[model samples]
Target: MVNESSVLFEKQGHIGILTLNRPPANAYHLEMLNCFNTSLRQAINDPEINAIIVDSSSEKFFCAGADIKVFEANTTEENAKMISQARENMALIENCEKVVIAVINGHCLGGGLEIALACDIRFAAKHQYLIGLPEINLGLIPGNGGSQRLTRLIGVSNAIQMLSTGDSISAQEAYRMGLINQLFDSEELMPAAVALASKLGQGPALAIAATKKAVYGGALLPMAEALELEKRLVDTLYDTQDGQEGFRAFVEKRPAQFTGK
Candidate 1:
């Protein structure tokens, strides 16, 4: 679907899966990012898809970050465009209406971790893999929404330490640090991630989208403003068909069949 490329997209029921397919390590460049963005847009535009998962085809390297070759012998204009594309891709993940989950079954470093951070949730394998923003080691820093999102997700001080040090931490440490939502056995990673996505996919899509908007968007505003935003979102949901269906189902002691209306 993407010129026989570095990413693959497939649908399973209500879930959309995007798999990084570059061999050895899914180190992405401009072309790969373009394909990845296009696939994500396809999922986002699909009305039938309620949840999406970002995964990989490799077992040893989730993604080794940007291909270093992109930085070699490239003009300033080309370099800027590359970084801009990476930033836009990250924003695409964060601003997507459908719930997104990143399943990290291998080492996730630098830009890879940044991509995971943009997702609503992350689950990693329990294998002895490392995860971090190791850009400092290369005498550069995360330019793909990593610095901003990482700080917001994991706190300023911790993010600063991790970025400044540019060192990869163990999967166990990443879990304890809240870098990942949970850790699964290597064999269970994708299945567990898919299980959660499937459950979410069955939920009321509009209300779930509203809640996600409230939490992520409201968190950026002041306290009073945030409360207002939440209240507004809740108020809107109450009038939706699914909301009424839920109420009637409860009164009738029957399961609600939401059509994501």
Candidate 2:
């Protein structure tokens, strides 16, 4: 019997792959959220894993959003717990040093889209794959980082329109809005995501972390403040062992071994 809980974790070479495995319309639940948190942490802690790709196992639905059944039967305490679980799960993805690429193969709705938004990059299948935050339909807004992240990804105006209207958009529209990084055919989605992750895995891990931090960390800051932060970050990297290795390797015309120190 398949588990109705949240996730399935697997490692492929240097890439850690996480699948949202709750099937027949994968919907979020507390157990699933906990599982995702545990799995993401495990992947992050593994030094051998240089990157992560979050994908779905089911054909029709990447995730159908939060488990409405849980909400339907919920007490106030239960609702609070569920919200907390989701927040933690999204934080796991967002704060992870290793780059995460969300492979949006099917229905990427509500909490599903929120989780995907936490990733460093997103690759989706063509137009038919629906994606949006529809929590407003249920008398709620996205409790995770959806509002903030979506605003950062697209823009405040587009984010407000999408979230407020509770309208699902095609993957093509998402890409056009600068919400998704790339588009792939349905048959090629997994391979494309894997290829992208593998490419990232082979690069300097520390540099990737620096890049992620500089962009996301500085997004809300003033231009001068962001520039200062970037300068400080680059200076920090300059004094590190990885910096030395990178320079020496460049001089020797060889690939640098990044210890992620």
Number of the top lDDT candidate = 1
Kindly report which residue stretches of model 1 are placed more than 4 angstroms away from their true locations once superposed.
1-4
Worst 10 residues of 1 by lDDT: 1-10
In model 2, the runs with Cα more than 4 Å from the true position are: 1-5
Task: Give the per-residue lDDT of model 1 (tens digit) for 1-261.
Answer: 333389999989899999999988898888888889999998999999999999999989888888888777678898788789889999899887789999999989888888899999999999898899888988988999888888887788888999999988998988887888999998898999999999989889999899889989898999999999999999988888999999999999998889898
Candidate 2, position 150, lDDT: 95
TM-score of candidate 1 on Cα atoms, chains taken together: 0.96
- The local distance difference test score of model 1 is 0.89
Candidate 1, RMSD to the unseen true structure: 1.3
Question: How well does candidate 2 score on lDDT at residue 15?
Answer: 94
